[model samples]
Target: MGKVTGFMEYERLEEGYAPVQTRLKHHKEFVIGLKVDDAKVQAARCMDCGTPFCNSGCPVNNIIPDFNDLVYTNQWKNAATVLHSTNNFPEFTGRICPAPCEAACVLNVNDDPVGIKSIEHAIADRAWEEGWIVPQKAALRTGRKVAVVGSGPAGLAAAQQLARAGHDVTVFEKNDRIGGLLRYGIPDFKMEKTHIDRRVAQMEAEGVTFRTGVVVGEWPKGSKITNHAKETVSAEQLKSEFDAVLLAAGSEVSRDLPVPGRDLDGVHYAMEFLPQQNKVNAGDKLKGQTLATGKNVIVIGGGDTGSDCVGTSNRHGAKSVTQFELMPMPPEQENKPLVWPYWPTKLRTSSSHDEGCSREFAIATKEFVGEKGKLTALKTVQIEFRDGKLSEVAGSEKVWPADLVLLAMGFTNPMSQLLQSFGVDADARGNAKAGVDEKTGYKTSVDKVWAAGDVRRGQSLVVWAIREGRQAARAIDLALMGCTTLPR
Candidate 1:
């Protein structure tokens, strides 16, 4: 809102990416963020609209216009302040989030939307460079302890909020290190782990204790899902030790393809494949690590996870990479008038896709063809919508050779054993059953036990997890001290 006519004068600027060849050589952030002047011009594109749908479109409800105006005015510190006030970690969202806020921008009805995400990335980075970001240590201690299981975005946000509100917050992570998916599930090229490591340091300074390699509940031995828990604490132990318990363990059970040859040696879950690469990047040695080098790769699923698989495979120097999507390809552009101010069904090509990969839609994997108990190829068929149901096209079946197959079909729910240990109820989708009302905010069926993020909502974006974490912190704070100043 710096200039009423600025939206008409400035064009939306997009963030740049490094060359594919250079980036494919290693696992690192390839996004070239906006410069100070470039961010200012982008922010200036914010219109003087009476209502900002971007505010609501964002899962964490970031103050888009206020920050935009701040950036336009060159008040970089204030922009960071406004951004951090609502969202705990702007850096994470600024880099990896699809920027649904931009989709719902007022100008997006016809014209190109303002570059809100790029502005946010600039502000967050500038804050770090200028030493504007610091630990917010509470003056008083409530002496009440909160045990949060999972060190994902949801758990981290809640722990920070609770700690800032004078509650003694301790986060328990089963992995050998913290950050959960942020550390392992996400590819480093999208967002480096330094972003998460810094936040962990800040939270530690704010009186939050993180217990890495210590699982809250027992993980099933010999499970396909990997675990690095060095120790375990029971549900009863947490109930007795802490004033409140938050079950924020993210959804970890990946959906599997139950076709023939599912037990083949080369077919693996996307989670299994992604975490190892990230761990290796962090200087951890993984014996017999999965490598795509010189092998034909086939990835299943069309979501963000699938895209990540493609990017990681390219980095692995795979011979050939092909991605499969069960649904028909979407229109390249959305019909704005019909779906105004909301996420639209349209084809989106990620930076990963641009790196190099062939994508096929309306195709389903009929079977995994293998020999000698190892993956060899895939039997697939073209499908189409008929009578509101997907049916196979006649004479469309084909077999393609594949040495490795990564299943990125997405997660079904939080691993059940962890929830069951605490007597928590699960929704039909196998996610922890919890409500987000004034009275029942993130509360599980068991008293004093709460759940949030992907554990409660099934698979979702990082921004949504942050929202639930902050809200649940408010709820826990109120229950513990009868009032809370934490933002909901």
Candidate 2:
């Protein structure tokens, strides 16, 4: 460690945000990351624990202590190398990951944990600025063809790994751009699309081919999630053309609230509203874009997506925003002794929550009340869990005015039609059936086909998606060459 007593001497310093009023006027990243010196100091706070739980806590299993020590010793370039060894896209994770690694930190038992995410953000940004990040072209060609479907974190990671291993890798994205959800679902206010674009350029240089606006299988007809695909390539074509196929298409079907008036004009899935804003940010003219301007917005479901809705609505100058959560409000702080070194149940207030919004907990919408086929209000009631069953409270029914209702509930599963087209079996939860064991890791029910990320594991964080992608790539490499040097 650079400073043995650094933990005792320093307090946790979080990245700053732009002023709410000023940031609302434009869609851009607002997080002010740590300076070089500050990042070094933050890295110094990493204690000499016998086991670095932060490594296990992180989905990608980043070498946290090694990077922390490297940063503390002023070895910025080496830190970036160590970071990239585990994570293909540290910039994406640094900006959006919830940092469960921090929750599992040794220091978090009694004090604030090291600012790992901020340090990672700094290291990646500095690496790019110093030209430490560049294309890693293969030394020789493997003469194998790999088709990776979807261009989100998982697919990108897999394609990069396979390409670096000398395979002819091609990524297919249904959206007009390379990044699947990252290019459209996430708002620019969180992370600009330039990050994705830069990586796409790097991957292209590494000999990975990107085919945008190309769907790999039959998209379900009339499915809202299939709106972006301009061209469809049958599953048979990919199977016959490629040596192997990796399905990294993320879970896209948003869970629906099948209540009365769900068919109302103003009621829409969060995806329906979010992608339009991202497209507009990318300079695309949306003829009938969904906007929250001067309207009473009601965001159903308390999660990252709901918080994103809150932030986007505020940026659109909504008259008012209210978020509803079916679960009861959690404690402000966790009981450290009871839940040490693991994610704890506690209240989380995002930057969006701090900006402005009303949050309602333990509330369930019974019906969407509207007039003339347009949403107007919601009939809701307080709920409670009793004897492992949810029951509505008597005499707690109420109606709230709403002009736009955004259903921000999480996704249920991947588009089943795509999986079925390739004859891949689905799990009980509707995710692709695949095992993560070393013997048959990421292999789908169908031969020569594999699945990873949200499509295989259900919806999850970007960090997890990257991890699955890397591991799946290793599995494919092993299957192809009878051995693989790539890390699992």
Q: RMSD in angstroms, all models?
A: 1.1, 1.1
Indicate the TM-score of model 1.
0.98
Clashes of each: 0, 0
lDDT of 2: 0.93
lDDT of 2 by residue, 1-488 (tens): 44688899888989988898889998899999999889988998998887888999999999999999999999999999999999999999999999999999999999999999999999999999999999999998999999999999999999999999989999988888989889888999999999999999999999999998887777668754466667789999999999999999999999999999899999999999998999999999989899999999999989999999999999999999999999999999999999989999999999998889999999999999888888899999999999999899999999999999999999999998889999999999999999999987999999889999999999999999999999999999999988887899
- What lDDT, from 0 to 1, does candidate 1 have? 0.93
lDDT of 1 by residue, 157-212 (tens): 99999999999999999888889888999999988999999999999999999998
Where's the lowest-lDDT run of ten residues in candidate 1?
A: 222-231
Model 1 spans with C-alpha error above 4 angstroms: 219-227
lDDT of every predicted structure (CA atoms): 0.93, 0.93
Error of 2 at 322 (Å): 0.5
- The residue pairs in collision within model 1 are none
Candidate 2: residue 152 Cα off by (Å): 0.6
Candidate 2: RMSD to truth: 1.1
